[model samples]
Target: MARGRSLSGPLFLLLGLAAGITVGRRWLDVVEVRGGSMAPFLLPGDRLLVEAHSYESRRPRPGELVLAADPRTPGRELIKRVASIDDAASAAELRGDAPDSSTDSREFGAIPLSAIRWRAVFRYWPPQRAGLLGPGH
Candidate 1:
């Protein structure tokens, strides 16, 4: 007895796409912490997993580590701690600022949901520190 089968063009294409999406969503896209902007928690060379999802799925709370687009450097991304927001009360209490305000003082200003690439889910590498890196609070 002999059994043989070959994938057709359409089936092969579909399989390829499914595989691509799975890999892209799970592991293809990743970022590494490069600055002390998010110090005391994340350090340079820390690999982070980035998955494309609804920006509004979860709100960025204070002290949470996030990967955002650097407004000053178009097309570039940065990793920083979410310290404040555009709210007067939140800023004033957490940071102290008025509405329509900016949180981080770096070249980039407030990061709209669109500017956010991904939230730091977990810290990889260095062996010693392997776990979630959410806000201190």
Candidate 2:
């Protein structure tokens, strides 16, 4: 007969923590604002808690903010508002509040649902700007 040795308590706990962190990263993410494109709303240096799971059930509506992968710059991301959606085409148009200075869907075309990483539900940084983003414009 052979006896099996299971993971020790601390080791198991560490493993669980690692797994949770990985899962949590995929389920939720955090992003920081670095530009003024979304100014007057989201400012430079504002940190936001991104709910990565929010769009798994339904598409974001117009005026709702979302964090999406930048089409022009791979590995980079952008935070923009949902401008329009085409269910038939399975794509969404995104726009920055400042159209004149923004490089958004107008230049990049509609982004696919897969590119939308998260719906920004809360602004958790800067303390002064901490608040829940209310429904649509």
Query: For every model shown, what is its TM-score relative to the native structure?
Result: 0.60, 0.79
Each candidate's clash count: 2, 0
**Candidate whose lDDT is highest:** 2
RMSD of each: 12.0, 11.0
Please, what are the lDDT tens digits per residue for candidate 1 over residues 45-87? 8776555453457556666666666667788676666666665
Candidate 1, residue 34: the lDDT equals 67
- Global lDDT of each model? 0.53, 0.78
Model 2, range 2-90, lDDT digits (tens) per residue? 11334354345345435654787887666789988887888899987677676888888888999888988988889999989989988
| TM-score of structure candidate 1 | 0.60
Q: Given candidate 2, what's the lDDT at residue 109? A: 97
Q: List the pairs of residues colliding in candidate 2.
A: none
